[model samples]
Target: MPVSPAYRPDPRFFDLGPDYADAVKAAEFPKHILRHRNDRAAAEVGLETLSDAEWIAHLGRFEPLPGQPGPIAMRYHGHQFRTYNPDLGDGRGFLAAQMRQVDASVDRPQATSARGASDRLRLMDLGTKGSGTTPWSRMGDGRLTLKGGVREVLAAAMLEAQGVPTSRALSLVETGEALERGDEPSPTRSAVLVRLSHSHVRFGTFQRAAYHQRADQIETLVEHVRALYHPQVQPGDAPGLLAAIVEASARLTARWIAAGFVHGVLNTDNLNVTGESFDYGPWRFLPHYEPGFTAAYFDQFGLYAFARQPEAVFWNLTQLAGCLKLVADAGPLTDALNGFGPAYIRHLRTAFLDRLGVKSLGEAADQRLVDTTLALLRDKGEAVRWEPLFFDWFGGFSSSARALSGPRGKVWQGEAFDAFRFALFEHEPECPERLENPVFARPDPEEMLIDEVEAIWAAIDADDDWSIFKSKLARIEAARTGYGLG
Candidate 1:
């Protein structure tokens, strides 16, 4: 295989030794059927040139990448729904390989230089889902349903398109096997998914060290995170590191709100130190601005619901702060925690305005626009959809004529949106040319609701048809281009 010059293998996690992860072997499947491949993402890491057979050999068969270690199952303990579980770890997946790649800010904010240095090379991980069983599998089978893989791929694509920092779905291969799962119909097809992410070090990683009372290991882990992800902070400044994590988490949560995304499971293990949203399960995009909407059926109490996400994130940060307490003092850590609320409010205003495609008119005016928009959505209830609202009213008053003439125009004309309309007129559109994209001419914006997701899966499950799935992704790509959020 001809590896491109961009591929720079960096097996730094392997250097962390056995305390952080364990070398493991991948399971042999009956067959490997390539289902999806993210060439755009693959090109970023120089894996786009691989032949289909070669792609399967490495990602599906789990063959080690050049100059990289074999599959290593990461070890960590996390709190599930506020309940700590020591047995939690990489039960079905492992870190397959690591490499350095140029920053690919696809529909995301531009990367900034850390410590005033042009550090464009980002450390990325080629991690797997449903690859095989590991020491953390307990007694259950380490497998993933084909439907689950499809859902995650869709979730990642939509989230990325909406400018949310998330893991990119690199490859998804269907393994010829039937597995029984209680969550879905029994005897479902199985698959393996590979995700590309900046970092795989989760908050649970620190918690595991703290749980074992290893202050030395906690210190080592902090240094590792600082050197790799937060180089802007000074060495040995644990409090600064925590504060950076808090800021990132706050920004991510704010982005989620702007995108109308509900990350059904907000467990500590699911949140990494980089604050990029990954390991998506039962994720959903809101149809309206309902605060009580939840994606996971198991979340009976709405712990990780649409509105409580910020609270869930803060609680998780507290747990992470607890772990850091093993190495740092309490005063600075508390101060770091104190930053979450204000950071979230600021990021939320910015994210909300960005979605509306409007320029901010200072903090007070921006807050009013955000508040009025939410109030209008809540007042209208389920009468209005989420994405279309942003799509129709994009560019503030510049889009007034188009929005009033478009679908749901009557809803916008109603007295309920009067305050929002007045507030929107105060700001001008940031990029009026983006509205010229053909995707804006469509009757309704591209949405990934549950019924549509089920329909897409039904086509695949019943007749092995992937046309709808492929078409949906293409449409989403067009929307990404139209939004031009990056």
Candidate 2:
């Protein structure tokens, strides 16, 4: 069945043709065991009515839905871990299809300032991972461990609850196989993943064109981006478009920092052009506000460390700017690249305040509040954890008492909260009622520490028990609702 009237078929990426992608077949699994599905994300693209079995049929087995055909493996090159790699693309996955979604612009008016907003451009990409091998699969078998899928589901759900712009795990299916991995135990369970996001186009897509000296292809790709994603992009204004993307990346980066998220691999291919975070591999949520925290174990040099995320993002943006050099003026593109730092700093302060459900008291006051809040957390040190600090001080310092009653109250009510409390008095909360939730009054807010994630996984690995996983997801969902973030 067609998803909805809003599901307009736009096979735009194919216009770039053979050089850009290769047709591929999805691997058929012996069993299509459904692991997770996001009905909320489904309704955004008008596919909410899908049954569990139907989801597996489409996403699991790669059955083409109305207005879409077989999946195509997109081709591009990227800088993985800061080194140029020309062989990368959808090595284990492909863009299955694209569809337009219903608009909620009225619910997000600030979006208009960027491009006046458009219902037509509200798009979603159906992409898969570990479903099969493709032209881009270099030497490795295209398979995903079930544990990997589980981790992804948890990561996306948690990030969404914290209001990070991230891809949702629309469907995850156990594929009834065993896979070997260096990181996890050998012969782990296998699964296939379906992800829903704004777009899969990455900075490396342009890098490939520029590398091959295809100025014409670069222009074509830029125009496609303008028409499909950023309609407000003025003609011949490639630099302007890059500037807009920088602003978006900065906004999301700010949110990531605010949420204490560290995307272990910030490779060029992993950073989508639309600024939506996807391909959750080795992501981690910090236990405390430690800048030097590194998520990926092999990050020996710690290039994409927690605190240097802003720097890494700027570096990737410069690479995108470098690609634009073929079709746009170098000076303007450089200027756009230079603006990232300020944009990140500005949005970070505002995002920090907004996350607390507090109203902005202009730039100066907001900066002071954000700076003071983070400083207080650092000052509090090892005694407090990340989530609890935000929990106690949510809606600013007014919720302190409610925050303290929780399991960690004694530690949360430390002396550092004194300056933090005064910091809250200067501004009104955007939503005071959020503090009324029972979550605030509890002795402990739900925490997703590494130990907790491992415990949940251990239960599954031991007895195939999903009770703990389900309960944890439910608790995270409750936190999402209680905080009024969703």
Candidate 3:
């Protein structure tokens, strides 16, 4: 990731301390950083800037820094997969410290929040996953699997590379613990604490308060999010404030669809009020034309399938509306709820077209463009393979198909569109023709699971060489370019 302007953590909310070794172990974060075996890898990700002592002090313990306040466990409640569960909150996670005065784009206040053009604000609750249970775990363990950490890291990086707006991982550690789960030998577990643009507040956060009739807490939380994320809104106007948040949430969820991502779990608790993507679990990008693709094993009914994500988001927003009703201003609130469908569709169009690297769509009406592309991909029957076409074409790395479907259609050589034809913009596509040709590849009814994906990455991580991965990325870029969306 490219470095933004120098940023500082909020001193009032954090206190940096020394007794972090035990806390690190207790949190089950990987000791890999302490081991420093791959100093190169560590440095590649900005850890090299920290002195050894600073590294231990900042990351090891949940300590506050100078001018920063001490840590506190945040209060929240969430629904698990649509079932109303009011007892969930920061079971193991806590607000470690706040990153104050940053000029990072994610830190930039949303248009609703930038009244004075002052960009930075306080965003806390840097969640420490695998920290031993606090107030919320219920019957479950607070520990997370090492494989889970790896999967999250991969998901964040890959999604960001694909231009998906998401929470970025700050640090991942290999806590030297042997907790038996499944599939692995020792079932080693680890900790991955992330630096999120927003944290700890969820739709369940509001739902919990509203359910218990704690209108004050609900109002307080809403004010805090508005100040931090939607600063432009006046707190006194409860209905308008609720409307802005609803619109933001709806639009954020629409981007998920534009990118073909499935959250797999859309519980009220998992939905962040800050309009940021959080809680990565059982998430998958579509690999084929099937709109009903689901990433979660437990979703037998496809409650949160790829196509259903839009509706799921609106459903969650309705729960938000119910919570807003507690404020006793239901007039404008109803209008906002009714506006979700149209607003979501508008945002989806903007985001997906932007991904194609197009400035705007023309009025000459290229309806066939979308239809033909989908048909080609469906006929080719390789959804995962279809991604490469966009990567290459949109990146301006391929041009072989530039004349395709033109009046001089004589350039067409065969019935099937040659995937490698676009590669002429760079050099001859290096992969074998059989592999590049759309005919030989058949789409199987394949659905990628977390474990299956981990196995693939395990091989890559085990080898410690990224040439293969890099080549694979290049192939994907070529394919994306072919699809006019690299």
Best by lDDT: 1
Cα error, candidate 3, residue 171 (Å): 0.4
Model 3 ranges off by over 4 Å: 1-7, 11-48, 104-125, 182-186, 362-379, 383-386, 395-452, 460-486
- Candidate 2 residues 325-383, lDDT tens each? 99888999989988898999998987788677788888888887788788877987777
Per-residue lDDT of candidate 3, residues 132-192 (tens digit): 5655667756666655665665565455544556665555555656677654555554554
**TM per prediction:** 0.96, 0.94, 0.73
lDDT of each: 0.90, 0.82, 0.55
* Model 1 C-alpha lDDT per residue in residues 1-486, reported as the tens digit of each score: 545555667777888999999999999999899999999899887788889998999999988877777999999999999999999889999999887774545332222211223244688899999998999999868888999999999999998888889999999999999999887898999999999998999999999999999999999999999988998989999999999999999999999999999999999998898889999889999989999999999999999999999999999999999999998999999999999999999999999898899999999999999999998888888999888888889888888888889878888856659989988889989989988888888878888888999999999999999999999999888888889943
| Predicted structure 3, TM vs. truth | 0.73
Candidate 1's C-alpha lDDT?
Answer: 0.90
| Deviation in Å, model 2, residue 148 alpha carbon | 0.7
Off by over 4 Å in 1: 103-120
